[model samples]
Target: MEESQLERNRRNGFLALVLRPINWLKMLGEEVHWSFVIGVMIVYGISQGFAVGMSKVSTMYYMKDEQKVQPSELQVYLGLLQLPWVIKPLWGLLTDTLPVLGYRRRPYFIFAGFLSVTSMLALSIQRNLSLAFSLLSLIGVSAGIAIAVVAIDACVTQNSISHPSLAGDMQSLCGFSSSIGALAGYSLSGFLVHLVGPKAHVDSIPSAARLYCFFSSFYPLHNLSGVTLTSQGVFGLLSVPAGLVILVGMMLKESRVHKFTHRGVNEKFLDAGKAMWTALKFRDVWRPCLYMYLSLAVSLNIHEGMFYWYTDAKGGPSFSQHGLFASKNSNLSLITYHEISSWLNSDSELGCSDVLFWYGMQEVVGSIFSVGAVGSLSGVLIYQNWLKDHRFRDLLFWSQLLYGASGLLDLILVLRLNLKIGLPDYFFVVIDEAISMMIGRIKWQPLLVLSSKLCPAGIEGTFFALLMSIDHVGLLSSTWVGGLLLKFLKVTRTQFDNLWVAILIRSLMRIIPVFLLFLIPRSDPNLSILPEEMLKMKKGDNTLESENTEMVSLVDST
Candidate 1:
């Protein structure tokens, strides 16, 4: 009988391999409701991941080409967009304590969807909006995304509590959905921009007429008859995610909450504040929290300055909205290519002379984003497999070191040092993006784990939200500081001579966080960082405990 069983196992190995995924899917369906699964995919996967990736590329191009915002000012405006995330705790609290039309999650999700859809539609259809309005529209979009994320996070938290054994699996599902959606979104961003063209057509006077005016030569004039989609059209497509979000709201299985009292809500808020204050009094909690804030604040995000340089610098490989590639050494080659394309257009009576000039060129920036997505996912895998068990202090120290080291790639790219080293601009940027994203993700993973570890027992939800908000505040601070740095260095729309200096400053500041490593706990992750008394709240504390046991589940699931 043993021999027969061994033979059967050997024969079914290939079949088992094929059925494993099917079996996993079956188990997932049994463990989690289908509505919850779909809601997560739409919220995290489409709204957060795909829409965000596409929006980043489109917004940069719009601000740079249409709004004409300089790198320094753009940095400030970009920072403003993060305001919603900085106040994420408020959104979480509202979802927890306040319900509209007797529904908590569904109303917020629907409102988020409505907000996102309107903002995206506004951006897409309106061509000549003022800079202030454009920024406001973008902020609205950001707010919508943030609200939806908070709502979905609340759902995840509730489910984690209801099904304790499936908490890890649920988190994994969320992470995987986000990563895969991000990868597809980023990989397609540049191609879609290139295909749709990054900017609306400016009504330029025919070049023939201008030449005729200057040279008094009889140049033939022809109307541009070719039609192409613009970046606005791409933005219009982003409405798909918002539409899905609305559907998720309508389809989500949530029971009606018929009870409400303003006094009760106020008391809950007071309890949450008191609990958070109590948790922060613990040195074990506040130390790491302070470190997390400092680590992010000191990094100094100068991405706008670097982005403008990447697309506009003469001596560097250019990555632009239109299929643009320019380098100091390749000017003649580019001119030749343009002239050849022009000649081809001359032979075609139906085509515009300049329309096809950039044909077949790659959207280099979008491709870099795509590559970075892969790197981020790889970082997640690496941490899960190897680094998840490491002591927090050691893991953070090496990741920070590598993070600072990898930042030098930006300096190299800015200085055109990669070209001197025989590596082309496009190839080098891809490698740099991948490495930087991987290191950044690695640095962030430990911080997330640490944040989860630090959350106290009863008020886990509110405290965790507060911690996330602190991180966003740090991000806001970093962005604003980077903008000031760029302004101080005189980096401008066409002037990038000092951009390298800004990069150097940022890279150097990335190392400052390393010295603050003393603030992090050196204990293994398996051990609780909090004291026993803190973890064990009095049984009589019903207000905070009853309400937030579900909330802390969100932390553990993360």
Candidate 2:
């Protein structure tokens, strides 16, 4: 009898495991509209895949190899592209407070999609586009994504509020979609780049040439006298994701807003602004906000410098697009920095012959990114199951400490120390990437949860946007400071003697936030961060009636 009972229990557990995914899908279908699910998949999953996996990688290579952009300059340009995100509050406020042509969320999605599609198409089709024009186009694309992100976040937040019981499931679905999308996109990125090439035929200019044309006029469209770099068809594929964003807008079901008045709009903005300001005055709110900002800013984002060093440095392993890990059947030999330099000096025939080899190397990096996506999902699970219950201060202190320690892997990779430990560069890099990505997601997850708990009832959207904007501001600061550090250290495109020093400095700076853990509340995740009065103020804010319930959740959902 005992043996039979144990067998039945074992069978039941196995069946439960097999049925979990189906249960998840059923719950999602029952909880939210089909259109909402589709919108989330496209916005969170597919968009992330294209942006990170394909567009980001291709653009970096295009700037580096074709345009000869210095590491510092690239950092600045990329930071500038994130301008729209830094002011996400504006997008959030507009979406929540104002309706366009009688519709709110749907029209914004349409606008975002249209803007992204236009920018990508222009970038792909233009043959001799100027450097400034290319940068602006990329910025436009980013703006579109940012707007769409704000809208989707609003949707998720509203759903979470309405279907409080299924909030966790909805959040999970969103994260899963993003993770799977990123994995698929990154897995295919290198192959796509290999097939299409990374270069674009932009008229390159001198680094010292000021892009005043961007502000003054569009007259200087291209420098015809400048060298025409290698062109690729990869840029054309970017339009597909943007087009899907449009489909998301069309598919999303939203009721028409019949109310309209300029005075009402002003009143809504005023109320949101007042509520946001009020929330900031609380020590619990402002202290953590300040800590989050300093933590991000001090970390310093010297990724561009590191990327150049990875691919171009003569003193290090040149993990170029074509040569790091050569397959057995490949005609080209495994290339080092010396070989890469010589190949560049060789004729077009030699370069053309090596394209396949270059793509094989790129695949290794793409695989690393794909692995990181899985690592990120693992992080979410680990946090949800274990760390979510811990006190905020303790959780952050240990995570921040570990975060700094993870930087040592990059240092080890750059120094080729793994080779001494019998680890191949490819194997070591993949592990390093996965571990770092997992730790990063873990560290970021708590802050997102904390941010959500801090949101007041009526002004959730506006105040959350304000908090996110603070975070973006920190990111902008980090990017600019990293650029300055690279320039100051003279870690240019080819010169990487001081690369390790920059890495060491960044790692040390990441540890500085550990000392600021006192700013975080000691309360449990279940406790509200805001004061009781702030929570109770939901009744009086009539101006924010239409806007308050649908606040943004950009980071929280991810």
Candidate 3:
């Protein structure tokens, strides 16, 4: 029988050789696939729902509902809401690496979900929201969630070793699951207030346009008099989904795998210390990490931050005109993403949107399809081609560079539109996003897989969690960073014209990190080692290789 990496560790440290249930289960039937899809669905459903739902209420649903808040205030509010997530890395380290109930990863994950559900429920009870309560609610939900994310990523990474070859596919399918959750959550949350009205549709265009004035929520109240008129008072109700996921998770024949797991005081400390040291030692790793962080930061910033411009702020190509165009463009992208990938990519009419909702959805759809068809496949092709002499260092580098350039493409698209320069700005933005997603899909999973392969035995979960934690901080930053940049753009709630410079500056900032990706070692320091020899090689520690490893981590541990 083959001595796996863990078995090899017996010679290194008694505690290091202990094999968890996860390893045996890897040989079991690959049932984790369903859980992954569902888990991801729940994750995206809740996480993204929180991210976008608040914005929807402020931008569309609650606009007329709250008079005290102006577009300016909402602009700042959107930026402020992400503050908890910005520091989420700290939260992850708290529950993940630390102990609770004598269990490190499990207890925190369970409690994290509970807090998430409770936070959602609490927020829903408050129909009348103040900035303080809202921020608190956001924080509570996000805090629990930040912890949940780390746990989920760790679990997924461990679970994934079973079908290790499918890591990329696993990640891609997870994307779809997340999309399903987002679209489902977004679509349903508004059903009560926006779709079926307590009152019938009003006659005439003006009355129809202002129909929000007459609708009432499921929760009855006299104050609801003009409640539906403005989306001002809506609660995210993210708890509903959280509750559902919890129930479903309970049915998941518990991951008894932890039972086989062994962790001694000294062993765990060394594991964590070694992992942390390795994380810091890898230049190639951090390079891609930095690029990803900044890219997502800018993309999301442009996405959420620019909405004020699309709405009443810049007053783009008239709401009606922009709406029709944007609607058409979005529809096109959505079809291209989900439908066409099913081999249905036919020539068709494109749509555009003035509404942030549809435009954003369009981008989401584009990214999904790109990930599966073009992006993942492209990276796989590159990897396959590199099977000869190891050149993935360049592959990884170029992939990241392309993603950065895609960011630059965003600026170019906006410039073209702003200057009435070439093709429409939407064209540039949409294509840029698609390419970005493609490169992103290609770049990220390889990085993760490489990390896992190279990590010293016994510290897989801890180190994997750390990598994800860092990337997420970057993801969170994407949400608010654009808003900060927009503050300087000051183009206004009415004039849509002069803010291209912000895009340019952000793109330039984003590009700087791509060059840094070169700092990562070009090869896996551990894959070359046999399972028997692996334990002796501490995870996060590098092995010197003769395979022409242009990109490698380190032989040193913190």
Top candidate (TM-score): 2
Model 1 residue runs over 4 Å out of place are 1-38, 155-174, 194-230, 255-259, 321-337, 343-362, 531-542, 545-558
lDDT of each: 0.71, 0.71, 0.45
Worst 10 residues of 3 by lDDT: 545-554
**CA lDDT for candidate 3:** 0.45
Candidate 2 per-residue C-alpha lDDT over 211-258 given as tens digits, one digit per residue, 9 for 90 to 100: 111111111212211212233456677778888778766655556765
**lDDT per residue as tens, model 3, 482-502:** 555665566545544656776
TM-score of model 1 vs. true structure? 0.81
- What are the runs in model 3 whose C-alpha is more than 4 Å off? 1-41, 44-106, 160-164, 183-193, 196-237, 255-275, 282-300, 313-315, 318-392, 395-456, 475-484, 495-497, 524-558
Clashes of 2: 4
The better-scoring model by TM-score among 2 and 3 is 2
Predicted candidate 1 versus true structure: per-residue lDDT over 1-558, tens digit per residue = 999999999879978988975675467656665556666777888999888887677678778877788999999999999999999888877776676776667778788999999998998898888888888988999999988888777656545444544544555556656767788887677566544444323233334421100001121122111212246766778888888777767655455655565557788787777777888888888888899899999999999998888777676565442233232333413332234335444644443423322322224566678788888877866776687778889999999999999989989888888878888777788899999988888888777666656665555555667788899999999999999999999998889999989988899899998899899989876566777666654444225432321211212222
Colliding pairs, model 1: none
Scored against the true structure, residue 81 in model 1 reaches a CA lDDT of 96
TM-score of each: 0.81, 0.82, 0.61
